[model samples]
Target: MPFEHYKEVDLSSRNTLGLPSVSQYLGAFHSVSDLQHAFEFARNLSLPCFVMGGGSNILLPEYLPGLALLSSDRSIDIMGDEVTVGAGASWDNLVAETLKNGLFGLENLSSIPGTAGAAPIQNIGAYGVELARFVVSVEALDLQNGLAVTLTVDDCQFEYRDSLFKRHPERFVVTRLTLKLSTRFAPILAYQDLQRLPAQITESAEGLRRAIQSIRAKKLPDYRVFGNVGSFFKNPTLMKSVIQTLEQAQVLNSNTRSAQGKVSAAALIQAAELGDLSVGQAGISPKHHLVLENRGGATLTDVLTLAHLIQEKVERRFGVTLEIEPQQLTQLIHAPNPKG
Candidate 1:
């Protein structure tokens, strides 16, 4: 099959942040064949390629020098409690559909942007659940030899906001994911916010989903209104000793613990007086300090500058380094159309 390829592509609106980017070559792959073909096309030219889905958790450079492959397949198959979803399927749609079918485990993850394929890469989580808990397996193409491989949950090596795929990004391109959900309702009320859920809405899947959705809507800035890529920094995790030091110094608030040894990044940033901070058109969201917004005409440089400023302030004030959550790309080869 001949793969469709385009050149000089404008991706200003592709990313949730609405940053302007131009690719020299862009390939839209709709099937396994198309995906492989596009990769081979880039390989032939010895150009670096970057695979993207839904354009959510990424920071792209102003110019991509090589191929930008987009996974656009959207297929979902359900069998009992097991679901096999295409990488390109809408993540929110998956959450909504699973609840509609009486599946339980995904309700807490509702309303996250990006495609199904991108979830496990960051071990995407929210409210009190992580995608790793439901992922049965992942199918990926080994870009090294153009072969396919399946990785079980244990092989994923999921840790706070990270996975093996994120660690070895150049080695594999994910194709699909299989998730094992539950037929019974079991809401996780461990999160402080969820613990406050009204009694009337705590028993059913739909109700829990709606409640989580409402909370996210109220707290997070709508990317449409003020462009952003959700949480801009990973919640900085500290060792027990380090946390104790910060606590003694009174740099963190009393209600900052998230897990046995972790604290909330937002709280630290807020404590450091980094909220509502700005650098050019990029500014920290006033509603949520962890979100960096594209106020308008924000450039990649502006975003990075603001991010650095935040990092410096948070670190100087709290002695903990703030790590960026989104993946950053200096450049990915997107070659020009040969026939053009």
Candidate 2:
């Protein structure tokens, strides 16, 4: 299809967080050629461009000033145990498809929202399995020259909830991803809840995926039901010495402490007594302390206000600064950063 651009597009329902926004110019691209053309269009107009996928990991302002591009290329190809997926492909669908084909590497990552391109950007993790472990390479468009390039896993610089794409948001527009899956059943049950699963469940790929889906369903609010972008804060991984100091001071609760010296951000927020905390219509999710929710008709400012309050309280109570997890359109918006 020819490249099409629209003006004054409403994006309230586009984002999982449900923040209302109106883009100055918006384009949806279905192929690599269309993607490059969109970038060129933005450049020719001297307008700043923002590329979005799935709209699951971003907070948009009331009115965006430039071009907004959405990836709509949803396609997947499986070669033996290796799967090369389009950036716009649903992440959960990829997991489901792989498992149905007897693949095992993605079971622990089941039920995650967003697209394949976003997976490596955030190094998305759950139930102890991270996307970084299975990624072979990422294909992206370098907007500088409107050229397509392939990036190796090492080149992506994956870290805890961060990557090279995140650090340099303007440089790469992820178009496709190639992941190396496995036919062998190798389950990772290191996370606390996953460890509690029965041997019958843990022994199989589909069984483990179901167990994780059940666990997440109980702990996290579905974006469809409640306006949210999943976890709002990254779990803080600290030095053992720092954890010991907090423990001695009786500041770190038992539930927050992990064997690897990481503390749950949710536990810290709860410790600060910020559960059910709200600003305007934005509030913390009662189901999971880590999530910030929009009760209804919430603004971007309201969400930021609530997030600031949480950070202030957690820092005051535990002396740890909580970092935000999602990418945002505004300057004040907190993009995912390394855990403190």
Candidate 3:
């Protein structure tokens, strides 16, 4: 049995929001054995447990109630063209490693922040490629039974920016992920920015990676210096009838229906003139309408207020609701109210 260590841990360093707080107890697990021991210890002590990966998508309040278990074991093994990575392994690192090995599918996802375990949590996607397309299986520890289980791709129940793990957070602690990648160069350049590259060039994976990185660098704020999560909101998808109503009202800037008939959320937000809206210290990113940034010393309350205001204004103007992407701290004063 692996021994578990617990202590009062500061969350400011663990979460990307950088909110100052202390978890009641915190521990790190390197292997399945370690995760099992930690789970048992939390159960014996009757404390709720929270699992964390790279901590990119969470907001912590001043005091968190339970133990936070961080996955810190970073290991990767490549067999033929299949790659197996520890949950704690950095997501970008895995992409880079795959590219170095001549694998092609992950190039479009380069530079995204977070760990491999968290990738499947949201089926992390960018520049036209998503993690779900390549994922073979995920290894997780069942917290309730203290048993390790391997989940196939279908078991993950992937959707746009969501997965079964998110819907059932308490059921499993992800330990590792396995992906199948291609050896030959095949690229997807359907995104507008990547489309600028000559068709012949984008036909190769290396060229696609360069194009994706270049586009992202120009569109997204550099996270190293700026304390901002990628996109603050998921583009609100709208039904065809809703789109027609908005169009008839002359309330839309531009509308593009997905093959599945959903309207684009970004287009709706831009049409609402919320691209440059600001509240207190938080504001919609001037560069991208869907992003909200905390301009120094901004509190979670400030961000939430701005988000609520945006939602309110959009609903008032076009009758559509905007959904936030990140998980907010439950105790924050501006936390979203329950829907009736």
- Expressed as tens digits, the lDDT of each residue in 1-340 for candidate 3 is 6445667777776766565668788888888888767766666676667777766787667777766777887898999989999989999899888899887799989988889988998889887678999989999886556678999999999988889887777676799999999998777766656767887668777777777777888887765555567877776677778877877776653434454544556667787878778776777777666667766666777778888888888889888887887765352221111110
lDDT of each: 0.85, 0.84, 0.76
Q: How high is each candidate's TM-score?
A: 0.94, 0.93, 0.89
Please write out the lDDT profile of model 2 over residues 132-250, one tens digit for every residue: 99988999877656668899999999998999988888677888999999889988987878878899998889898899899989999988888999998889998888788887876
Global Cα RMSD, each model: 3.1, 4.3, 4.8
The 10-residue segment with the lowest total lDDT in model 1: 331-340
Index of the highest-TM-score prediction: 1
Better of 1 and 3 by lDDT: 1
Please give the ranking of all candidate structures by TM-score, highest first, separated by commas: 1, 2, 3
Could you give the candidate ranking by lDDT, starting with the highest? 1, 2, 3
Q: What TM-score does candidate 2 reach?
A: 0.93
